[model samples]
Target: MKFPIAALLLCLAVSGASAEATYGAPPSGLADHLARLKRAYPDVILDYDKTKLTLKSGATIPISDGRRDKSFDELLDEPDIDDMFAFPYPAHAKPAAPAFNADPGRVRVESLFREIYGDCRQGAAALKMRRVPWFGGSVLITTRQGVDKALEAVSRDLEKLPKAMQKYLAPSAGTFNCRAIAGTTRLSTHAYGASIDLNTDFANYWRWSKAGKDRKVTWTNRIPAEIVDVFERHGFIWGGRWYHFDTMHFEYRPELLAR
Candidate 1:
């Protein structure tokens, strides 16, 4: 079964145990997967023809470096351009424990991010950072790709949420940090000033919980679906949807939201 190349419905959800058991596997059709990305960030990515992805800046990146037979550790430790889309991001869905190893939107290629956002550690990413007004104070975020504007819209909408939900949002855990992801050498999207973590008091991290001998992570979340829906509505992807969930995290990934 082939989807229309132009329609390219990129997001597909798997429920029950399938979400965990086979979530890491790549989507069956690569062409459609890449097409969805092309449609999502038209300004940044001009085209993707399976072999390579071309940026508007005239730079070309190989879609697949052809390092096959990757181990699960390899996917987490190092993923190429195509691997980033191995798992589909479940937009507009209620938070659930992701199927085993179903960490979508997490396997980012650093060079790809640095190319667009610039290196935050060297002041490039930070240089593009701007302040956006939030609940009570303004938050620092990148102005690139309309991120700061999107966040502003999100802030305004979040303010309309019930007063009880504000606690999960206020006094944010910090954004625009140029630091490596905890337990990994790779810099996170937050380092690019494109991601934010909500109130830590209501957050849940897989690492915070003790891992079983088999490493079956116990998933938990305090943030509500209403909050997640607002973030998705404004072009942010929630970390709570990933199998290796981070309940308080949300990042600007318009490519995944282009659908």
Candidate 2:
């Protein structure tokens, strides 16, 4: 059987840039990527056979969709399971500025999340949300997969911080809001009840800042390193690390933040 020319072309296309990250195709680093994922979330991942996975649901999902040409927008809008690891997450690398396109943990596969946390549209996900006490008040967070336990541990440590740090932690901006991100159809990590945003007064977002004439966003952070460190130690990734920085956002993505 003769192979299609399109297939041949795709093979060549993916081969040329297999090191850094590929937009549309399955990256060559599939094994290492999946290994890290399984190590991070052992509950839902179950097992994989390199090319596909037998999820805890007993359903099989392909690791790649096989397309080789995708723009940044396309990668965000439509990504396969492997595409989630296209960009290598710089876990505990530093607080320095990241490269232009290094929003590693941002490229999430919706189905993977849906499988573990349940679909938000059906309200199944929200039912798992539980309130965790923080700064003397309770904030709703997910109880699934030890999330509530992890947050409780975080709160315990946070309480020991100096009195000055208390102001930034509360009044809590929000948590467990089941809604899509503003201006995009994709749901915010907050919707999964696995993320939280601190007080808005001390927070910063790229959208509110003015970009340069060259269109590069100026990164700014003001939430204090102490608070960021506490969250990082507790298995959360900080939004201040991204090129399009958001100072007050922290999501529980342990895989991206090495302990």
Candidate 3:
């Protein structure tokens, strides 16, 4: 049977339109995510492939370990690069209690973090430290990827807020301490000198809060949205957003916040 040329032409036009629509769609998926990672740290992430990320130092890190059965704790402890996105960071969203185990920027891959911010164990991170002025004081932060500058930008914006908000920022709990996270052998982001903890007085941590009969730690935040907003705009993510809340904590994680 012979097909009608007019109908054939009409079908062809529709097919072309469909293809164009798909091609023009907003970027998503692994390739786009990888490109964002490269853009987030142009100096460190040289390039990436389907399975690995190549660093400027001539080293490569696997993107995934091919394990999808990891428990929440395992994802935190043995995370690969892909696991870092286990939870999509809800950047700029109104602050609210996150669902259980919804810690977006918490599943860090130690190797990638060490690559971006030098490991502090051998005093390498300290070597890159720059003292940026905070509220009436200074905090030691890393110069890597201009993270010190990011913190400075955050401080400047925070100062613009009403004076009462200053209480939450002044006398920062600390920054740039080469210490492991509580109850874990893994190094905290603080160890990389890329994190800042606001005043401990207003801080609320899951470990410090009482759990209900259901064993769920109640979420609480004393830090104002104004403070979290400034930090996030400058590539810092608030720990208070995590289900395992740490209200005074904010760490620089540009990759997670990239659009």
Question: Each candidate: what lDDT?
Answer: 0.81, 0.77, 0.83
lDDT of 1 by residue, 1-259 (tens): 4766434544332232233332234456677778876765676787778588889888888887676656666776777777888887888877788988788788888877876777877875444888887778778998887889889989888889899999999788988888899998989888988888999999999999888976788899999999999999988999999878898999988667655
> Which prediction has the highest lDDT against the true structure?
3
Worst 10 residues of 3 by lDDT: 19-28
Clashing pairs in 3: none
TM-score of model 3 (CA atoms)? 0.86
Model 1: residues >4 Å from true position, as ranges? Answer: 1-26, 124-127
- lDDT computed for candidate 1: 0.81
The TM-score values for the models, in the order shown, are 0.86, 0.84, 0.86
Q: Candidate 1, TM-score vs. the true structure?
A: 0.86
Single out the weakest 10-residue window by summed lDDT for candidate 2.
16-25
Scored by Cα lDDT, where does model 3 land? 0.83
